[model samples]
Target: MNDKVGIVIVSHSPDVAKGAADMVRQMVGNEVPLAFTGGDPGGGLGTSVETILAAIDRAWSEKGVAILVDLGGAETNSEMAIEMLPEDRQGRVVVCNAPIVEGAVMAATEAWGGATLDEVRRTAEELSPA
Candidate 1:
């Protein structure tokens, strides 16, 4: 019953994304697949579509993948990354509209528990304001 789903964290600051990923890893241990992408290619505060895409690829799982982003641009770039995926792969990827840090922690924990993608996304989204 290996029902683990993968997670991808995207943020404008590399440190923020990495830190959140670290926290999630601490929470879920190695039971879930996690990847993070932050900052521009030049190492400045910005998100990159390519980086996001790569992180998604690194964290790819048969169960599914959920993405959490910090801000509007991060969300936009994440959408672009998903779009760039092949048609077959795109359906399994979801961009979650939840707070990056909290969402990553919640999603990772749910995935570790063998939750499906919808269940993990719901767990993360439940933390957002109504």
Candidate 2:
């Protein structure tokens, strides 16, 4: 199996996160590790550190993980989750600043192609508006 950079999708809405992940799978297949988190543990529409952490674990890889978040709150919570990881993992994970859906799709595509973390991040970030 290929050990491409992993990916995590974060959103305030669970449905949105799941849909983005689904799109990634359809577009890139499952060669790259992938996970997603959204909403609070209480089932409300908000970001959650716990859920984000869990998603990170699910998508963890020595190749590292690239996170795509849907909103400010999701990004903030994703940062918190990254801080909570071990030092080794902390350094490898990155939160990409790009559109959640499009970014995730492109990020996964890069990862599946064996791109490095930075390359995958750039692939997603390039999707952003100038």
Candidate 3:
């Protein structure tokens, strides 16, 4: 796996993140790395920063990583996650606002082929009509 890509999804509810991850996994298979974060502050519906950060690390370890966020806490959570990542790995992570389904599908497709984080993000942004 000289060239590989990883995925991370963040949302207001863990269900949303997991659902998106599951769909992407089904589409792309289990070969590549995938991470998801969501849930409420007091409830167990969301993952801790450590969990998300670990996933981010694993994703970055390969080729690069792309992060997709739904809305609400997903945005703030992703931003915090990026800040917590090691400085060297910062460039490997891209936080994008593409729709969960379309963005993830496109990102996973490119990731399966080992696309760079920037490439995946650019593709996602291009796909986004917003």
Candidate 4:
């Protein structure tokens, strides 16, 4: 596992993804690397598959990257993004189970240095509101 962990949140709109990232930063103090994808000017509505993949590449450049996505188009975008990663790095990317807000917070706050994907996943699930 990589010591540096990255977060990628995808949603139907940039605001949703960025909002999720913002929430995580609020808890974790912006120490962790996080990226936003899904929407932007001229980027079209719904999840941005290419944009998400690009963000993942950048995030993974520094460390491992995990992905969390909103429902519908975001889910499809995430899946496509995962497929785009190199085989070895693919395992480092995860689609979180919890909602974007809770999942991003759990992934960011709980992802200590050297934390594995399993640990991150567990934390996200554990921290998610029931």
Task: Report per-prediction Cα RMSD to one decimal.
Answer: 1.2, 0.9, 2.1, 2.5
Of the pair 1 and 3, which is ahead by TM-score? 1
How many backbone clashes can be found in candidate 1?
0
**Residue-by-residue lDDT tens digits, candidate 3, 67-96:** 887765666777787888778877777787
- Candidate 2 Cα lDDT to native: 0.92
lDDT of 3 at 60: 57
The lDDT values for all models are: 0.92, 0.92, 0.75, 0.75
- Residue ranges of candidate 1 with Cα displaced over 4 Å: none
**Reference-based TM-score of each model:** 0.96, 0.97, 0.85, 0.85
User: In angstroms, how far off is 52's CA in candidate 1?
Assistant: 0.6
Q: Report the C-alpha lDDT of model 4 over 1-33, residue by residue, as the tens digit.
A: 336578888888877877887887787866677
Across 3-114, the per-residue lDDT of candidate 2 in tens digits comes to 8999999999999999999999998898889999888888999999988999999988888999999889999999998999988889999999999999999999999888
Clashing pairs in 3: 38-46, 39-45, 39-46
Q: How close is candidate 4 to the true structure, as a TM-score?
A: 0.85
- Model 4 spans with C-alpha error above 4 angstroms: 40-44, 61-63, 127-130
Candidate 3 has a TM-score of 0.85
Question: Which candidate tops TM-score?
Answer: 2
TM-score result, candidate 1: 0.96
